[model samples]
Target: MKNRHTPCTECRKQRRKCIQISPDQPCLRCQKLDKICARPENCALDPNNEVECLNQEVNELNQAIQRMEHELKTLGIKSPLYIKNNTMTLPRSTIENLFYNWKIKINNGYFTIDTGIKYISDLLPHYTSIEYLSPMTSYSSSSSEDSWSDGGSILIRFKSQEYGGFYGLTGKMLTKWIKKRMLGQQALLINHIPCGSRMLLDRLVDIYFNCHNLYCGWLHESSFRKRYSQLKEPLDDLICASLCCYVCATPCDHLDFNAYQRRDMCDYFYLKAKEKLVDQFDEPDKRLENICLDLRSEYEAAKVQTGIDYALFARHFSVAYCLRITLDCVVNKPITRQPIPFPVMNTLPDELEETKDFIRVMTWVNHLYEEPFVDMLVEQIHLILIGSTCTISFETVARMDQFLLDFGKNIPSEWRLCDNVFDEAKCRKALDQTTNPVAIHAFLHFAVLIVILYVTILQPVSVNDENDLLLQHIQRNALEKSLKMSRLLLYGVQRLFKLKTLSPCHVKLTSMIIMLYLVDPIVLQCSSPIKSSVLEAQKMFQKCLDIICNIRGIQREDTPPQLLAEKKDIKDFIHNGSVDIDYYDRFPDPWCALLHDVSQFFI
Candidate 1:
């Protein structure tokens, strides 16, 4: 009697001899009868081969268990009990113990179970494997007739639920913990200020109102002056620091005397302000709100004369100040330092209100004032702010580009070129004669907006191989043209800063330009001409940085880590004739993060 492979299921049920040409195909009899056919259980090439296949499968399973145990040992974790359950009993107690250990180790920082949970959940079979398991006498006492497959059914169900629950719970709890920690570690609001004179205080406050307050107008001149007079001997450092920031932002002609005196006074006040803002006030937000209220009252009184809407001005200014205060509080703080609870986070809804007010005021400015420069400046600021903060779609980008292009046509030729260096005397003379005293101010504002637009818009455009080469060439040419225009705009900014004609806003703007010079995709491309242009732009930027650092007493080396990192890359390129352009390519938009970081330096 000869042994043979098992017959197909249909053939076996019928107790008929099955004839087949291939192992995987239907038997000849079943195919002829047009019946569905499947291979019989325990079927193989031969009796010995079936056992050999089972041994190989068991060996592979053991090897996998050993590998998992080795990995567990490497991570300093004890091997799980399931690895040793070769009999497939998978005890319910062992499964529970494994989960409990995982929970403990997860909290102990031994492992991050969230990723593991996701991995396990993804690897699990969609349907339960209980039906496939061999029947066992251990669970035979259960009431259900199909419930005698050991603990595999219970273990599978528990694993599915446990992993999903743990992933969700851990994520929520971790986020809650982080937010709570941030609230506890709020940055100090104010520090002590060195003693100063009433005259110097008055001068600083005047500068603050004239330069910083012109755009922000968060502080009213009359109310600020009255407060200055009412306060006894030494003024509060918060007020004093705010005053210093004002003077630091003021141009030379805005000062009564010489540039040297102006710079010296600005520096003195800046340090005092930083010390007070960083060290003194425990509840900076409350103090800042009080200050803004006083200014708001003043803004209401002079709203008719200033031709600026109080609600719009106050909201925008307050947001800027809030950001400024937050940045100052964390400036010298470490990145891994306890999170500082942002007071402004609660007031974020006010930003929407501010946006609405801006649109309303902008309509008034355009319709009533009919001032193109003012309209353009407001529009540019609106677009830049929106673009920087939001997730813009392709349609929004296209619309914004069209809007800017239309506005660009109206930009004064002098604004496009760096033909005239910003001269305080010349600026004052021009303002004194012209009907629009705010022309230079508007131009400076426009310059800052252009730099922002460059960072947020132009630099990010790419040319793909699938695109028409001619179209690509056209885009590259346009990019080169825009890069030149950006450099020229930056040149105007540097001149303004050099002459002390711009505000602290220019410091933020120049810092952004420096960032762009470092990582702008066009500049960072592996091309000589573009790289040389970037280096030239850096020299101009260094001048701007020097002037800002001189007033703020911040050294170039003391700049933010992101900027410093870019500087090193540039240095490496200059020395070794190579730079890691790919490092910058990793960023979605490298300048976006840089802009965000630099914006903190301002309001």
Candidate 2:
């Protein structure tokens, strides 16, 4: 209402350089910001009021600076960086190396920083080359052959089964690596199985790498700070490749492999499966030699195509394979006993098979560990528990209840929310649940370590039985193994509970077990169970009978038909403790809960 006053709408709400809307219809700043212009009362803001407020702010800021200066003067201290020498003097870094341990943070598993970085970098141009790329340059090269080479044995020999070294000089690394190497030689074996069995290895790799597409949105640290989408074409492709790589894992033997039971490998069929999988790859990426070339920046137009999602592939493959493996181990060696010793590398002092029983519990817990399901189920639970506005169906609740039965014993999870939720206790419980996806991963890994320890520590003593020292050493090694893993388990549990996303319930479970283990290793060992074995002879015998019975001649050179009945005898001999369904029914609720828990937490 004051004379010569600008309208509040134009001045503050519109943020325009306004004299008065009555004087001029258009506001200047509105045009600059490309916003719509309107009458003064269009907004609740008053321009004169805003000006006064701003002036007060300016005064406050000045006073704050003055106060800060006076405090600094009294203390005889200026800014924290107030050195007499204005010139910069970079001090020698105490840290030997400053490298980001940038790992691909997948829910169920993690990749080594070095492995992930190297693998992803392979898809992108060299750091130096990326710096030189101009928008004018093209990125026409989109061939695996142009990417990396058919490093003939590198994939199998280095990355595949003998995969223990995938993380660190981990105990599992040396052993698994060797195992895979041996398996890759299916051609030479007396009985050949699939070399890359189930093609899970590659699929896991593909899936993780493919997830890089999501990375394009991530802000970079540099000047442009561009999202992944803003990057040139090839870079995008490389990112896609990284995401896909995570998906591609080596598939394991199928559970239904009973129908296609393998017999003695005659060095012929062994070559077939290996060749078939390889031919599928057709043109192998033989860029191994020229992988160092930085030509992408110089040629090809900047056009890109989305790559694969190898992580998804690998995840699926892993789920199937791991399930198959779990079944194999359990089927081959069932734990009929009540209490099991936690598994030790060599042999425990007294009854270490008890340890293996604990591992059996871990296996049970694992069946529930499906990555995709966890996130979705967690979401529903969150909505039901926390969001009064949302209503979840009884059917959904039942399913979720079943999920809880399987894997929720120790995990504290959120009811509902989006983005960046970390429950350390739940994560710890997830890690400890034995049925966790990574536990199986670490299982295969620990197997390698056992193999190494056997080879390095136990094997030598067993082999060079010099003065009864071997058994003693083996016992000592076994004790150390149990203690070491127990410690890792304890640490993993503690760290897991601290996560923000975990619930108090999971923390309690983790703490309960942690308390037991911390209180007494002997008690934990007594309660723990043994790990199941991985090879089943029942299917083997059944298939062997089928093949022999199918023979035309009464006595063929390949396999004697007379031995068909003998095969059942062998099967009966191996599966001595096989019991009735009532045996499973007899299990109490807690055990039932454990089973359900595993089904949910593990895939």
Candidate 3:
């Protein structure tokens, strides 16, 4: 007998031969019956084979489902808003909720830079106060889980100190003071840039995105590039110019420019930006130059006010008072203004929508923190005037100390600092801890402020006051505080340098920290633990220098005299494990000079 194909289920049921035109087509008998042409083997009607047949059908169905799923997954991988494991990578609801919670916090001023914990213990809460998650029940025992879910963290209310109210110096008055005093200071002014190539400008902007924007995130990369390419408005040019200023101020080996070249380029860009914004200084814009002006004001204030100089104090005080009362009426008002609206927050396209949303929110959050933090810094500078007249009083010292402590407490959880740096582990924690560069800036500033305050308190006694014993005690305390804070400051600067986030402006801050170790007689006279701390600081400072050297290109004898001299000092310190302290005092760096002038209120 000749071999033949099997009959279909319907044909076999009828005991008829199944006829088909092709293997892929339905059998003629099944087509006539309007039924599926199942294979004859699958059509077995024996009771024993029934379950096997159903099982085969079920397996076939499962295979088909899997093939479809695989195709879907493949498509998902190509999609921007991909879903994985039956869930969105970043759900719209989740982003919306996070943004809502953040807004609530902002509206309540809960996340404000100046809002400290009501109790200091809140920073390091006891384990007993914490709630743990209970195992697999209908209920969770942890209140923290619910609190976090509901966006209801503990709210701490603390007393806000009169920051810039001591001398009635307003932000406006301070701005005027800087502009007025800076008029004839041609050497300090950012020089005008003649011109530049679009190619070079583009390269600098790229450098900014790769280096600065990674840590700062102040500029949304895609949005900035897009806007810059268009150059639709003067604001865009101004923004680009400012960004170039920042990049030029820092040495970039890739830029192949020496320190002087970079400085000149930075000055050029800065001057261009300044000319554009010359009329808008009083406007409420988060132009970085404004916060920068605080630094300049401190410099000018230090320049004008010196050790026990009543005549100089009277003259500037009168000028400042006149400016405050007549020219700037907002002198005594608290700085509660919101940051200028973000340009790209709403304008960004839908591609990588979740990431864009996050960037937008974080940019706003950074701005929110920056304003108050800068205000507090200005207040700290104004407070320096009190110390400038005479030795800072014990009450003033205590208040200032409390203010700093409170400020530390108020820092966001992600950026919060460990106050005690005496412990090696804590110092490492501070150094190892990572956050945004803006936070790093805040950390460095805070440390600098602490060092300045304590250094002011430890001034030499010219005529012994009645509080001589108390003075000695305060001096000892100030020395210890300054040492601890200086260590913290060095660790911060080291971190900043390591991140490639340190700018020339930050170099000034770094120098101030290093000066504490290089000079400061009280710190120098200390024993083992303090010596160890100083050694640790020296190592960190060396690390910062190494990073700077690496980026700016290696130190060379052919380097400028000033740069070479500084390099030699660093080399000597590295080899001898000590510095020529008198060498620093005799021919101080600009930062050291500013530091000396500011802290010149010795009794």
Candidate 4:
């Protein structure tokens, strides 16, 4: 028992005013911290203990002061007076507040730090108003509307010159920025595509507008056609080649080009586009006025797909983040435009219903990508992973599960998955009804995320009481429902792949899901009766590999020796079921490690 006036050791160390619950119990601070509360014995007589405790406190305070000073030096604050002097620019408190808010935004994964010209624009609020003014004159509010209207067009003559400076200069700057940021393979020289038939070119262009244009929606049809028809500049070729390359890489059907021909064409266009993209970076004087604002962002996004596939998630996320920041600048702007109608899409034949469904699903997915909720979801998951101060209870998990169910219910009937079964005929029917592959992918991802949540927090317990039994039952039901949902969505995705209606993006998503999400479950369940699930997962994995094999379409016999060998290596590995883990050593660390982790079981 401690004296009533004595404080706990923890409270004394922290210099907190502690209130004792009782003389025999811990102090309030120690109790709240779940720490042992020690009080000095015979405090009046034990002069050494008091001196030692005081010395310890002084040492700790000195260490803390040293740490803070070190942090201040690292932050470029030489001393307290240095920060005080800098208050002329921004008060220390204000700066600290800004930094604190910025940190919170970063931790929550929903922040935008404008870089380059965007930052300059943010600094100059009146930039747009004075953009067309002569450099010699100071910008004035009194400038005539007529003068502005007349000169705005002259100064910004080409749409490419909308951002001012030399034509295509921003593109060059962006390219450099991208290169600087990239951690993986740097793009080099790309060869131009050989001349092809006029009909083939037109078909590719048409396919892009009808099937794929919605995903990026970068180029306005009228503007793109105006430039594309003339072909007077590299922008026309860049847009055409990039779109053609993307379409060819994904699921598309054409009567003129055989599988081999299509593969060759895709390679040519992709390489040509890559060359053009490099030229965009290399040639500063090149005209890019025709490139739309959306196209510039798409240029970054295109790297995510047509480059090394889904291997660079960081790069993919970087592009998404850059796009978010770019949009956030104008998110609050009061501007409204009438929705552009897609008459060409309406004229599409019934046979392309699956493709249309794909477009819808991808568009929705892209929409979700631009939303802030994804960031919140990711941040919450991260907190849960790190076991942060905030505790998310099983009831919260149940609520989230219910929320997902409610969301699924609210989805249009046409977009809903039919069931978990992967029947060909039924899947085909469901595909016709459900046109959004992105939604299917999202459902699968969300289910997996929920299962992960359950696994992360679940603990072993004995069912000795009603509460224990209830907890066990909830855990069982939650896991089962989540796993079933995942299986159902996975099956749905499999159906799409089998039907050859899924896009290249889906291929990327599938690869990510298998490599990152499915491996553990499949491996752990191999010895269980649910071995059938493992087999299904294997089939899904095989389908992805098959897609990769034919990814560039069928290659001609004259394909380069290296590419031929590369294709052979993957093909043989897939068929032989070998455990040569070194075969995948070329992949990024995560992929290589994960593939190696699950190779034996999957094989």
Candidate 5:
């Protein structure tokens, strides 16, 4: 009896019958062609045995579906938008009713604000307050859910405070001030929302972020809810949206392309970001040198206004930080099979092949900065100032860039690399806690983190009274000193996380990790059981070690086995100050506090 499963091609081409190996590989037929050949992809099973195979396949698929359903049920997570499982439990009539009301307010000045949105709910309770309603405390809970809070309790409403020697204006006073600023203009009044409303709406149109637009219309009093998709992809800013357009013509004059229309605006920014490093590309000196000049000019302007030499110090100020951030990403991901020891080198003392990856990332960042990165900074300044109601323009970026180039060129070689080492312990401690957000957050939020500080943290402080001028001056100095102390901490973080990789050309890499709300103070707090923050401090130190070991070139095998076995001792050689508190004792408590704060964030 001959094997019936043998392929005819195998027998004819190979001059032998097929064995039909479990993971069928190339038979002699493919060998002659010098190409990969395998069992036919769509070959059917024996027709006589077809039902058996079909039944088995059906069972396997059923088992998989069951497992997934069980997992979802156990996890208490609804498949909000999955095609098979997603369903809108809400009535269509309810949604249509809301859209009716929102339609009238689409272009209204009041709808664009924080106060006039109340009518949305009263018109159709389901869409506004009933469908997606959640409480303040609820935001702090929930997983795999989209929840964000930009302000504390005072953000949505007005609160009154008694003036008995203890006070600034109450929430009521602030509201009045903002209202007066608007002066007869309309504002939105939206606060409460419906429960599970986000889930229902997301199911209808398919979105989870709860960020896009919602339309409203007028319908029967019995049914006032309706929903419609806004016709544009969500974008973080108008500038980014304009940049992403592929249409050769200007935005208003041309039709928008729908090619990547399904992608969220946030994803689109990164997609475009990976393309130009910004919205523009640089050709060596043409792009980069022009950027540096622009930045230096901005720095000079800032310096003249405040005597803080924003231009002279900004580049040096940014160097270590930028390196840590860009390098960390590349170094940790290896190119070779070697056992990579971590506690990545905080500084590149010598150039090595392993360090190549990190250098490449650095080159990209450098190019990026010299490219549209300068534009981003300029745009960022405009955003902060405009949103906060101040005045600024691209002129500042140009000044800062020019000033920095001169300052950096004039800097002594040793100073350029932090060779002077004033209080090396301080820098190391700062370096040690670069990865921990909790420590950094608490430090930044310490003492003056009240309402006033939120508004004043980076603003100029002015006092009108002559009698209290001296006291006010002292407070102002303290704030400025604190800011400088924070910057020193930031530099430590940037330099330490630099990475290395193998690339055709040598690359220099450096970076600093800036996290969003989810993985940060929140995760930092969640990692430990203790609430006193002492546990947080320990975690900070622990995280620093993890990142150090992540450096591309540094590994246990490269160093002496004995030293590698005792990691702490080796780390001391690089940064011994981190483990010792006594050396830091001589420094002012504020400085120590800042270091402590910086360290606490990573662990």
Candidate 6:
């Protein structure tokens, strides 16, 4: 065996001689230290290797210098003296540290150059940039037009090529600010009972599977259980909150059951879920991937078992359920005195497929469950789709009209007659005494649909330029029929309102009153002859508004600012004897506004 003349790596690092028995074996010192013996000959340094290594290092240094200069330019530093002084040689690590500290200060609203300089100087005294000392007070603004308000919020202005004049803080800044706001907002443990209790867990799971599963069934039952059992202190909070929300949402049979406890549990868990969801949204990549994977697996299994593409359906259902639970908790709690829009109408337009899927599922579920609430939900979906801001084709309008006609045909002859000639006092007495939840829910949906139909009849129609007198006559006849239908529907609404069966604050009910108010203006502005009845109709609509506001605990002052503004314009038009049908077109339909409020649920 050849003797090892070259020292080992460790010995070379320590500047000591290495002793080895052979070239193949480790040195005694390396063996004692339990380190692998490395030989200098194994490296076999070449003249070209040294040159290449030096070049690489030099290139890295140049890149670092360029980055520093670019950063200085971005920070609005342009003084020649500062640039020359700051060009001092700095190690990569020191440059990196300075850049990081600079970013931290900017994010924290410490924007002054002098303060940044002081901070960086303390961080790296030996590697100060000459630009830091420049007395140039003015800095170059961001390429993206932005303005900082006194409130410490930055409003970014987008070009017309983008989403023009879009003003908001950057995503990162908004997330940081929100986190700072929610710093002390801890999830409250209202229930003293341990979450791991088997009895409670079983009951909650059963309730979830039985009732809430149809809509919010994203979590894989088996996987969730396995993960939940293994979770420790911190993570268990989310599990507990999620389970509790499901349990609390179950409809209880006992009249004496403590509703307050359920409310508290729902509230706490909703807050936790909302916070978690926001955090998931802010993640750079693989955001909510774990949850999505689980949901996908469940959906696949469901498709195999049910033979239906429930993937899109389930996603929307779960989202809507989450939003609904959160909104319900908030509405019941009422953090503010201002009236909140009805939760059903608050869906986002981006979730077009989701909304369609939700509606389809609701229609199917109504037949399967025969649940009054599900039926009501289907009707609400119908209203939302009809009132959608998206352009509706003639075919879609025809379909909607056909659906309404079909619905009308399904009503009992006696019920249809009662709608037009029912005794207001008797109806009121019966509604007050009615105890059936299903009946009350059904009536609410039915009445809302009637009112929506009434308003829909007044929607302006477009005529082709080539249409002759024949088409005009046909249109007039159709309009008269629609007016008759509206009058019949109005009678039903009056009876229902008089009975006080539904809350006036209920969005559907409030929207009905608004629709009625719109009817008079619409008819009066039409080319059709205005009789004395038009004046009476206007007086009656005002009376209805006054009554509903008084009954529903909504003061005139509590009305939405936009609605109030519109009402004032309408009043002014009446006073000036002017009829502007264009006024109605300018403002969004009230029903569409209501729909936008609840659209987040479907998303």
* Global fold similarity of model 6 (TM-score): 0.31
RMSD of 4: 25.7
lDDT of 3 by residue, 51-112 (tens): 56656766666687699778765665555433322342344665464335432122211223
Identify the leading candidate in terms of lDDT. Answer: 3
Show model 6 residue runs off by greater than 4 Å.
1-277, 280-403, 410-540, 551-603
Per-residue alpha-carbon lDDT of model 4 for 285-361, expressed as tens digits?
A: 55343345335433444332321223222223433543443232223221122112111121123224544554444
Candidate 5 runs further than 4 Å off = 1-44, 47-55, 63-603
lDDT of 3 at 547: 41
- lDDT by residue (216-295, candidate 5, tens digit) is 00011111122123323223223223333211111111122221121222233334334344323223454575578546
Runs in model 1 with CA error above 4 Å? 1-194, 206-218, 245-400, 407-437, 455-478, 487-603
- What Cα-based lDDT does every candidate model obtain? 0.41, 0.30, 0.46, 0.44, 0.30, 0.40
In model 1, the Cα lDDT at residue 504 comes to 56
* All candidates: CA RMSD (Å): 27.9, 30.1, 30.6, 25.7, 31.7, 23.3
lDDT of 1 by residue, 1-603 (tens): 235568888778766778888877888877866888887576746746656766676666668769977775544323233333234455576556444644322221123334233322232332123311313223235455233222333211101111111112222333443454321111212223222667666666665655445543355455556666777754454765666655554443344533434434444556556656544322457667757755653443432423233444534544554344223322311112111221111122323333333233333222312333323333322222222111222333334445545454454443322223223344334434433213333444444344433333332322354434433443354345445545544444444444443455534534443433333322222222355554654454444344444433333443345744663323333323333334432333332322233323221
TM-scores for the candidates? 0.37, 0.21, 0.40, 0.40, 0.18, 0.31
Backbone clashes per model, in order?
A: 12, 125, 2, 4, 95, 16
Error of 3 at 257 (Å): 2.5
Residue 271 in candidate 6, Cα distance off native in Å: 9.2
Give candidate 3's error at residue 154 in angstroms.
36
lDDT of 2 by residue, 1-603 (tens): 223344445346523345433445555545544556556553444667756766676666668769976774544333333342223333334111222333333221222234343232142323323222222122323243322222221110001011111011111223333354333444343333442333432332332223321211111122122333354431123333332222221111221122112222212233444444333332235343233223432454355322222223222333344344323323322212211111111211222332333333334333333333433333222221111112222233224324433433333222111111123344344455543322322332232222222111211112233524534544444344444444434445445444544333333333442332232222222221232111121222222223222221112333234422231221221123222222222222212222222222111
